[model samples]
Target: MSNSNAERETWSTRIGFILAAVGSAVGLGNIWRFPFQVGQEGGAAFIVMYLAFVVLIGFPAMMVEFVVGRSTGLNAVGGIREFAGGAWKYLGGLFVFIGFVILSYYSVVGGWVLRYVFGSATGGYIGTAGPDEAPVAQQYFFDIASGLDALLFHALFMALVVLIVALGIKRGIELGVKIMVPAIIAIFAILAVYASTLSGAGEAYAYYLSPDLGYLIDNWKSIVPAAAGQGFFTLSLGMGVMITYASYLSEDENLGIDGGTIVAFNTGISILTGLIVFPILFSAGVSPGDPGAGAIFVSVAEALGDLQFGRAIGVLFFATVAIAALSSAVSLIEVVVSYAIDEFNVPRVRATAIIGTLIFALGIPVTIDPVMVDLYDIFAAKILLVLGGILLVTAVSWIYSDKALAELSKGIGSFSGIGTVWLWTVRVPVLVVLIISLYLGIDSFIDFLAGPFAEFLA
Candidate 1:
């Protein structure tokens, strides 16, 4: 089919489109990062702020991206240029590049989950460390985080992503999401139920739910940025992944309702993650305050080691996580591939291969060096995401204001009345908040860079 004809074909069903978008949004960010961020950011307050941002900022931005994609029926660069004009085409390119960088590091992390699932199945790391003490588990995680082992797993992960994208939107991407998203939710529900039976589950619930306002006060400088970043990441913003996915959308669907549904599902999974993870940690007598990625792997692995059917539980948990991670990675790769297809007129398969090859090459530093991996993760999550958000806000608000409103108002008859509300109230205020949040996020990241030397010595 011609590209335009293909674009004309909307999702076979609304559920399919919602499932696909939710699959892209609900991933490692929801399961892996959200719990840890909540623990670090004083739990309840951070959760509240995150919800607020999702409603005020993330929801509107999602609508904007959906409008841009469906209205133009083009990938990111083409969508922005067509909707707003030539001046903002660079904004779309920025989104594509940001998506590229994010997927590079994200694939590495997804590879780690793939390895963990294998290890869980093989009973590796079981019985190696006590729940309250995870030194051996931490070392095991570090060993896998570096060298040729890491590279192999990254390649394996990237290959899975490429294969899915090569299958085209309807056959591969949408179908995979339809299956994976439901599976993720089902698995998480089962685990959350299981976690509630742990000895100190009550304490875990308290830790996650109770608001320690003082912690938020003391850590506001750090917590706000963390919350904002997590909010954006959880919703898959600033990456053009949403734009690419939405490009497949037909105008008959309601962007606002779909966008709200996606955000709700994504945020719900994040909360579910906290429910599952914190209970397990607290029950195992592990401190939730331990910073760094190792905190999750070591703590959760140790907890699983002690359970009655720990091996099986570990396998299921990590398998779910790995699937979630891979699903998001595929979405990210699609963004890059879509840009290639749209801008360079490359075939979808060729574009997928080309982008996959570049990611495979760029992933080496992350696989070989622990420090580089951390730096890459930090840069993509903190710096590039905020920059992408700023550019998107500029493009949507100033350049494409009328077009955005018109597109966003396509369906839902009188509900379009709120277009003015979205633009003047939600969009403008959130843009301002994003600006302030971006500055603070950058500053906090710089401080983290500067303090590492002291932390190392200590």
Candidate 2:
């Protein structure tokens, strides 16, 4: 069969694809969610477990998607069907739908980050710290989140994402990622360094780096799923984002090294976020608020509010978040566009415009209602993501294992150290763990909707 991918967009360079993948993976989840998970899950223990998932599961899962997309050289739905046959093509559609659902709420959250950047720039949150911090940050978040301001910023964020996707691979997605990824890293690195200079910095390091074995033992039930979810979430797996991104990669690029690079950069930035956030929060004598939007918009904002050069720090911090948000949003929106272009033969620009506007409209309710955002977010993160992951691995293992391995092994040194492990990873241990992760994710979400939740960290 002729490779349809030959006719589609290709990254101009290997670094472009790697950076774009990293950008997709390292978003609000890394900056906002990872730190809280570390603190809640006994620091180093959670890190160890999460890394195990990455090494044993996450990386292989990623390779599966890459093999599917690159081998078929098509969008998620088309690629799966082309390779796997039967009703399996619909599995790709499911991922596209999940991506749609994710972007609807994700864009709204990105808008919230946008408002924070603006507020930080103008020093609107400067005096809201100390005793009144929580109320001020909460009030500010709710006001901006529900008000027309959210819609405005949401539109702006969406427009930026659409513009990039419409520009094609070489000129647009790859280019934007090249600039955004480095800027995100440099600014965050500077922020982390500055945070380390704070008086209570040692305390922050202890909280962030020290392992609490007792806490791990006590909270193992809660910690397991959180680590599993974070591993998938931080890697941007199970959402068809990687499938579409990998479709653009050429035949010469080695999937193992490229995937590893993306993971390294994405994981490094997440760890850097912890370094920046904990020190500031500790020195300011503020506990990380409950594990939702409060951690970033409220608790961290309060901590930064009292510091010298706080305004500058806040701007830099939120700026880093804004870039991460946009980068990830770009990939999500592109997932939608790629599906349309491949399956429907729609023009990239027109597809992007239509899908981007619709997602923007869909997000309005989420942006307006705090409850809606929370519910939709929980559903996507826990249910859709986890289930998508299970389905993804199953398809790769049963339907197209040999084909995936063939694609992945191309232009590589030797598969001795890697291929056998990656193959069984999809077939056996990884599949079992993903099944468990899905159960845990669903059980957690059920408890979430039950109100005043028990055991599970919200």
Candidate 3:
């Protein structure tokens, strides 16, 4: 490659960089996972706790990742090693491994979204809409989520991710995010406006927006960890994805302001998603606590099917999700490719190809088995994120220390005062809460597994 091409590969305009990072941070975790988690954790209460965690914990943790990335201009492995010295490089390796593991399952769900988009266009699930939409959607979802059909779509999604990253930073990553982010927001906004007109919209809003203080008291043991994990997942934390994105940023950007903007945008989109989805589902008489991730698909599509513009709405909604999922998947692929290029000195195109191929291969199990899809989803969402957050906290608090803090304070003048508060008070307490929350979450999860719910899995 020419030097000009190589130089072009490293550069991204400020807006492009911000959009790209926000695009990665905002995806299925926000749209799909957030509403469901809120439904389970008592809606408004979960939202309140989640917002607190996002502002206090997620934001500071994001800044630390940003600091590491901008300070070293290296991928996760190189950044950790450079900032924390020799013994801490393994922490970087841990991040790379987690990122790879997450991509394997994440691509599976992205493929499902791809399948649904095409299915909606072809009128596959249109006739199957019902009051108890969960069961109907589950059957259709199960039929498509496994075996050769899923594998082909997963390969297709992975291929798209590879093609984008192969184009390098500016033309590929930044440009795609620039287009996709606005498209996602515009489409979701249109849906939210339409949902507002539904007959059961008022009841749906109450169900989703009203504070259920009693549920919070009953489930606080489970709710804390669920909220924290959801917060981390929505921000794409613990997988080194943000760290990779931050590596591309120039020092002139204020880490505090940029990180805050990303978090706010991500959180805002999630809130909009809830407004769009829950109102529609509840207005249509669908319960919010419906089991399985496919519940949303079933409920929303069924409601849309009954409307005058049902097919059109269904097509647009699924299409929005497909675009959002693809944007995030591309970011995940970029993280892996960035590491390959930075650590091994591999060409960007070659690294993208290699990592994409590996993810495609690893996604096979999830694609071929319905059970494995749910298993992988649960493992990644519930287990991997909590463990990854723990590692991130340990690395930031104990290993990097003042060096990380110093890098975080650079360029952003106001950040020095607020950043110090973040370091000593906010960061430490949040980490402690995450640890305790993880323990409670695991205990509750195990108890749930061993209880009557075990039969459902069997």
lDDT scores in order:
0.80, 0.81, 0.77
For residues 1-458, could you state the per-residue lDDT of candidate 2 as single tens digits? 32355578888888888999999998877886687667656666687677788778888889888888888788888888888889887888888888888899888888888889989888775664466445665667767886688888888888888999899988888999999999999899888889999987999888777777787788767777787888887898888888888888788778989998988888888889889988988898887535654455777777777799888889889988989988888888888898888877888899999999999988888765656666776678767877888887888877677777778888676653577778887889888988887788788778777863432234
| TM-scores of the models, in the order given | 0.94, 0.94, 0.92
lDDT per residue, candidate 1, 135-240, as tens digits?
A: 6667668878878888899899999999998888888888899889999999999999999988988988887887777877877788778877887888888888
Q: Which regions in candidate 1 have their CA more than 4 angstroms from the true location?
A: 1-9, 128-134, 453-458
The C-alpha RMSD of each candidate to the native structure, in angstroms, is 2.6, 2.9, 3.1
RMSD of model 3 against the true structure: 3.1
Considering summed lDDT, which 10 consecutive residues are worst modelled in model 1? 1-10
- Point out where model 3 deviates above 4 Å: 1-9, 128-136, 444-458
Model 3 worst lDDT window (10 residues):
1-10
Q: For model 3, what is the C-alpha lDDT against the true structure? A: 0.77
